[model samples]
Target: MTAAFTVRVQDEIAEKLDRIAALSDRSRANLAAQAIEDYVAREEWQLAEIQAGIDEADRGEFASANELASVVAKYVKAARQA
Candidate 1:
């Protein structure tokens, strides 16, 4: 079972949503609900990870400077390849 609610979106965003819905052969409401669900899940995960990091910091747990440089160097190497 599900509950219904009303929402207002900007014209451009609504149009884009409509276009995607039509292309995907889905109702606008279904697409909107799915997008909302996905967004909420992603945000919840991000917030939890942030809180965990804060707790770690509070506990005085941190990476060594060499560990940080190693991570940064890996990214820099991958970026240069790209």
Candidate 2:
């Protein structure tokens, strides 16, 4: 089942969507839905990774922020020298 809704976009964005639709031989609506679906999937994956990191922190399976910062600084210094 699908529901229809109206949306307003900037002229430039609308024009780009039209061009994409023409080139892809897809309706603008279909392209918009696919784009939104992809965005949602990416966000879900990111949230899962963040949750795993939080769980690891709760379990004390991580380094101190200062230690991490020092390691990062060392890498940055090496990159700068290279």
Candidate 3:
């Protein structure tokens, strides 16, 4: 099953899409559909992760002080190195 729809984009974006489509040897519609698919999949994963975190919080699940400190120290060390 499939659905058809129309969307509007800025001229610059449309031009960029056209260029990408040509370079990839794909039609504009195909490229657009793929882009939409990728975006939807990424958003769905992020939403699921966020909901899981909320559920965990509701159940009082959280990292211990040492765990938090470990994460912070890891990032701080990385930042200092950068």
Candidate 4:
């Protein structure tokens, strides 16, 4: 099953999409649908992860000071090396 809806885009973006569609030999609708699907999936996954972190915090699951410092130190060391 499929549903149809309308969306508006800026002229520049529409032009870019058209170019990509032509180059890839795909319809603008197909490319737009795929882009929307990927965006929605990423947002859903991010929201789920955020909620899981909040649930963990509600149960008092958090990194200790030592653990936090260790992570910071590791990153700082890596940055210095870079």
TM-score of each: 0.81, 0.71, 0.90, 0.95
Candidate 1 backbone collisions, by pair: none
Tens-place lDDT digits, model 3, residues 16-75: 999999999999999999999999999999999999999999999999999999999999
Q: Score residue 65 of candidate 4 by CA lDDT.
A: 100
Candidate numbers sorted by lDDT from highest down: 4, 3, 1, 2
User: What lDDT does the true structure give each of the candidates?
Assistant: 0.97, 0.94, 0.98, 0.99
Tell me model 2's lDDT, rounded to 2 decimals: 0.94
| Candidate of highest lDDT | 4
> Which has the greatest TM-score?
4
Better of 2 and 3 by TM-score: 3
* Per-residue accuracy of model 1 over 1-82 as CA lDDT, tens digit each: 9989998999999999999999999999999999889999999999999999999999999999999999999999999999
Model 2 CA lDDT for position 82: 100
Report the lDDT tens digits of candidate 2 across residue range 1-82. Answer: 9877877889999899999999999999998888888999999999999999999999989888999999999999999999
> Model 1: residues >4 Å from true position, as ranges?
76-82
**Which 10 residues in a row give candidate 2 its minimum summed lDDT?**
1-10
TM-score of 4: 0.95
Q: Candidate 4: worst 10 consecutive residues by lDDT? A: 1-10
After aligning candidate 4 to the native by TM-score, how far in Å is the CA of 75 from where it should be?
A: 0.5
- In candidate 1, position 72 carries an lDDT of 100
**Every model's Cα RMSD, please?**
2.0, 3.0, 1.3, 0.7
